[model samples]
Target: MKTAYVKVPFQFKFEDVPVPKCGSNEALIKVMACGVCGSDMNAARVEAQDWQSFGHEITGVVMETGENVSNVKVGDSVLVESGSYCGTCAQCRNGRPDLCASGTGLFQWKICGFSEYMTLDKQCLIPFDPEKIGYAQGTVIEPMGVALDLFYTTDIKFQDDVAVVGLGPIGLMALRLAKAAGARNVYGVVRNRKNTARIKLAKEFGATDIIYTDETPLEAYPFPAGGVDKIMVTAPPSVIASTFRAANLGAVIAYIGIDYGDRGTISFDANYFHYKKLQLRASYAVPALYFPRCMELIADGVIDVDKLVTSTFPLEDLEKAMCTLRDDKEKEIKMVMVRPELL
Candidate 1:
């Protein structure tokens, strides 16, 4: 078997490794496809974390399972949960498994998705009908769940003018979900003009407008009265105040972007922040509570996974794919890395 690790300074390396043994309650999975997330990009830059063998959004087939594993059988098609949590914890008991402290080292030692062969507990694998949704679409369930979590946490309604600030993969998925949830005018905001690839798809995903903030000023946002009803910020924290800048009266801003930096401070006028009655909320979704619903949506054709993914890479080309993301982020949207033998 071969395992991959994303080293610092944005590099990818692979080495020969033994296939992990399946435990009594675990499943041995054959890698199918793994979605390259924005978080993966963020993880590639840090010095403190291990980028080697760190991918969570994965879909694969169960090659074998331990004798006692009954949740999934051999040949089951499934999407994997990234973290292991103590089910008895207070957060777990309260249905907030994302907050579980037990799984604090998510990307450190977990080698499942980025490797050619992987192992995970049976409970971490969610089975779906592969005939209905293929492996590529299957990989999206996890990330889509993150977007769905943000949508579920907030209050959105029909005809609400929604603005999504940041056109990354999750932001694009948010655009699709906002449209599906009945937002009348969906706006996609980007910081670069070279992000034209994502902007075009944002329109297809039901973005009524695409705001390239670099070319167009924030003051020129085309909302009738003021700004948008709800703003979903998926970019850096520095841009949060700008979302407030283009916000409507009593708008809710759900922020989910993460950046490593001394660049966290955001400035906005105190009077406008008060007069408009703006609400800013952090949208951190995990433990994949909405995984099933998201999978069903993709399976039933409600959400088109076909449009969201712009490229696919063989596992051998993992470095090239990650570099494409690092060097050409503006032109790229979503990607799937696959092990050819699995399919």
Candidate 2:
């Protein structure tokens, strides 16, 4: 099988590697589609040390199952949870596997979903209905789960006002989820003209207002000071400081952006937070328990994952896809690589 891997910073190569054999408790998944994530760009920019592979958001078909893998069988369509956790870990026992104390987490290394075939532990697979959803939609389940985690961290009421300080794919997902959760007014902030199109889509999905940062200053927005109940920051670290400055006091600020190196810092008014009792929280990947609910939400039509997809590429074009994402942020939202031969 030819596995696509990041050989060095901004360099990708297709290496002919031996197919992985399923372990007793693992399953062999034939890659269907794997979404190229923003974090993957960060990984590609950093020099590759080991023969590491770089994708986590994946959806595929079960080609072979290990002897002990009964949760899913051959021909089952599924989304990979990507984040591995030790069942006995403190966080896992507390039903918050996103904070798994185990060393098997995705943050430690790569999962290599951008390949012809990938093997996963049985516990990391979430079976879904493929007839209703395509591989592109399934591939985004992981990121959507991350968006759901932001809501889980904050108190989101149906009538509350919410704002998202970025219009990336994840930020767009947060916009959609907020509306689905019955938020009265949802706002999306973007700077680029292309991103403005995405923000408009947010309005179609559920946002009541799309704030183009380039057109209007954050302070000039109609939302009053401390008017927003919750805010999600999805912009890169370079823009986060200003985004944080605009956040309403007493609002729940959910930081979802992954800082790329030391781009910049976020400055907050300590006095404002102290007097207004603001809650600042950071949300990473979603917990395993949330996968089932996220899948259910997709199944029930609460989230249209397909609409968020902007482009697709073949696995062999991994480098091109990554370059497009890194260099042309304004043009692309989410890009997914598909391995049709493997499927």
lDDT of 2 by residue, 251-315 (tens): 78777776644564666677867776778788766443377777787888877776777788888
The candidate maximizing TM-score is: 1
Which residue pairs come into collision in candidate 2?
none
Question: Among all windows of ten consecutive residues in candidate 2, which has the lowest summed lDDT?
Answer: 102-111
Model 1 accuracy (lDDT, Cα): 0.79
Estimate the TM-score of every prediction.
0.92, 0.90
Residues 35-111, candidate 1: write the lDDT tens digits.
88877777677742654677778889899999888888898888786655668889889997768766522443457
List candidate 1 stretches off by more than 4 Å: 47-51, 84-86, 95-98, 103-109, 267-271, 329-331, 341-343
Report lDDT (Cα) of residue 211, candidate 2: 77
Superposed on all Cα atoms, model 2 deviates from the true structure by an RMSD in Å of 2.6
